[model samples]
Target: MAGRVVRPRQLAFALSHTESLTRDNFLEGPSNETALALIDSWPDWPNRIMLLSGPEGSGKSHLATIWAEQAGARAISAHSLIDTMVPDTLVTGALVIEDLIPGTFDERALFHLMNMAREDEAYVLITARVAPASFAIPLRDLNSRLRAVPVVTVAAPDDQLFRALIVKLCSDRQMTVDESLVSYLATRIERSVAAARRVVAELDAESLRLRRPVTRALAVEVLRDSA
Candidate 1:
């Protein structure tokens, strides 16, 4: 039987579902090993309060979501934390805040929320691309408090890890790729997981459009235009 053609929205949903957060879905490598170890030690942590920080596409948010699933923790986006009061939004266990370094001016509220979570003996994990020190935080108290929390940074992936990530992403998308092609991309594309991911996504979309399998030629063409 012929498989049904995936519409754009359907493809989007499929990709989202396949890439949904789990420790297994997170590609393990030297760069992220420390963060994974820290997350794995979550069971031993007295305060589930942890912070994961790294460059873009370093999988900080992905690991945060894994932490939530493993500990039955609540994951909340940054926008929600700003627009809504903490007590009103989070009434129970752990909470995660993503993108805490950029325009994160609502420090007083976050400071109070941290105390509340501590009082309740619940965990709070904040994930960001950069460390809190890089932000323009005016609250001295909050700055000191945030600094005390253990922060784990995900280093950029190396060539091997990048190749593995590309293959994993393609597999998750149910797309077949040749090893030689992955090798070509690993050497040619930008040296960031974010770049590899974007290239794969573009190739996937292009393949769907042209009804062709992704090859070295196609990859090169797509990357050149995008780069």
Candidate 2:
């Protein structure tokens, strides 16, 4: 008992960090160029309604925030759509409906919103994980309207962007990581922004738990244990 090595108990701390969603904080890369361009085009868009499609954590929300700021748009989740609130939601002449999952939101409310937006010449930006055209909407008219909207897909990040994302994610957590850790993670983890965020969070938590710095060795163990 006297020679036993005591391990530090891992305490869960609610670490708070602010992620900048401003336009200046956005990282530009080829994977999201079209999506970013669409947001920048703003009132000059070809259509009053458009859709942004990408996987989870693909910066769809961030782009929506940027467009919302520029266009003076109010942001709301698709699930909150009520027929009665459509008018007030579009008071700014622009609106962003985020995380629209197929068959989850009310069809009538969406249809009414689209019709009113058309009549009022208001802009609507819908963010979904997949193209809205692929959604199996029960309302034929609503399906037709969704099919007509232009869609921009955010592809997975490229190598340069992937590495940069890992670094940025670490910075967001206030972790002091060098190029060695960044390069090691780039090779070990999946090449996606979401994956980068997840691994960084894991590394931070593990480092805190083990009372060690975020070195390549810690990353190797964290990744191995996670895998």
Candidate 3:
């Protein structure tokens, strides 16, 4: 015991992964077919203004990116909306306002942007966790405009899509997971893309620290520890 030499444990570093948001990278399933169709419809949209809604990590941003690429749209955050920026924001004749929340952004700026887009026949794509129609916007005209805009909602992932998402998330982290681990995670975790991303990230970090391969046993440990 006196001669025992203890090796230092490995340090798990947090590295950033750039996820591909291109059209080819998006996974299609029943949950998102309608949303995909809406993007593909493009200029033929029911209205020049459209609202894209979904739960977090439900691929709303991804679909928005695809549409933006096709439409040459400029992307902006809802919080950054300003009355004076409305005209310049739509220079490309298209815009994407991401992560819009009620009461967080300038209601007047949005109202002005909507009117400007309508006047110029520009396309505006708004992404939010919930539909804008459901938001309690104080601006009466803005509320009416948002309610009239066509809404496309992305639902939660199905079984096949869930498994595919787990695989994709793991691959994004450069972790090679087999079916057993995938199946185990699918049943054990919440059925959402965000949940899959979180669990896979945790497992990867844990495996690196422990110097162990990712497997069902490792998954059990990670899941339990997180719980």
Candidate 4:
């Protein structure tokens, strides 16, 4: 019998694997210290489960992926888990489940999967924008389970961290960012690591379009037009 190939719905989330993780890729700031320390000292045993919850652009996924690499781990999205028929045990090595809130409703399945990972001594790193307590799980179980797990929250990066991140991202893309432009962006844009990222990405595209270096004027115009 020929099996059918069913295509799944296109998910709104985006995960980039092409990018490499280095110290340059990680921005240092007080906001990220605990998370950084956990990442630096990863594969800390018994139960290798850590939660990364934060708003977009807080570098949760980047840091998670970096930690996975450091521990020779593999990253997977929660949506794929729903679509696939494979057993959890088949997913070897350290595991990163991005957007874990979506899985909280399925208590039995999630609990089973977590237990399986624990039994096998494989690391499980789950990330979500919201904490687990906010999910649609049965109140008592969800509360108890979440409290037992080690939670690491990524705070929105500060201005210094944001500027450093933008500069590093621009450098990685082989683009030069002017000091005035960096200063202007650090103050004028939304106070978020994510906002800095979008602005820098737009600058990259616009730089290609205009065939000119990214400048303070270009940043202001693009950001204003975007707003």
The number of the candidate with the highest lDDT is 3
lDDT of 3 by residue, 20-103 (tens): 788988999999999999999998999999988999999999999999999999999999889999999999999999988888
Whole-model Cα lDDT of every candidate shown, in order: 0.79, 0.91, 0.92, 0.73
| TM-score of candidate 4 versus the correct structure, residues matched by position | 0.81
* Tens-digit lDDT string for candidate 4 (136-177): 666466456765777888898877788887787777667788
The pairs that clash in candidate 2 are: none
Better of 1 and 4 by lDDT: 1
Determine which window of 10 residues in candidate 1 has minimal summed lDDT: 9-18
User: Which candidate do you rate higher for TM-score, 2 or 4?
Assistant: 2
How would you order the candidates by lDDT, starting with the best? 3, 2, 1, 4
Predict model 4's lDDT versus the native: 0.73
Clash pairs, candidate 1, are none
Residue-level lDDT tens digits of model 1 in 175-215: 89998889999998888878888888888888877777888
lDDT of 2 at 192: 75
> Residue by residue across 22-74, what tens digits does model 2's lDDT show?
99889989999999999998889989999999998888999999999999999
Checking candidate 3 for backbone clashes, the offending pairs are none
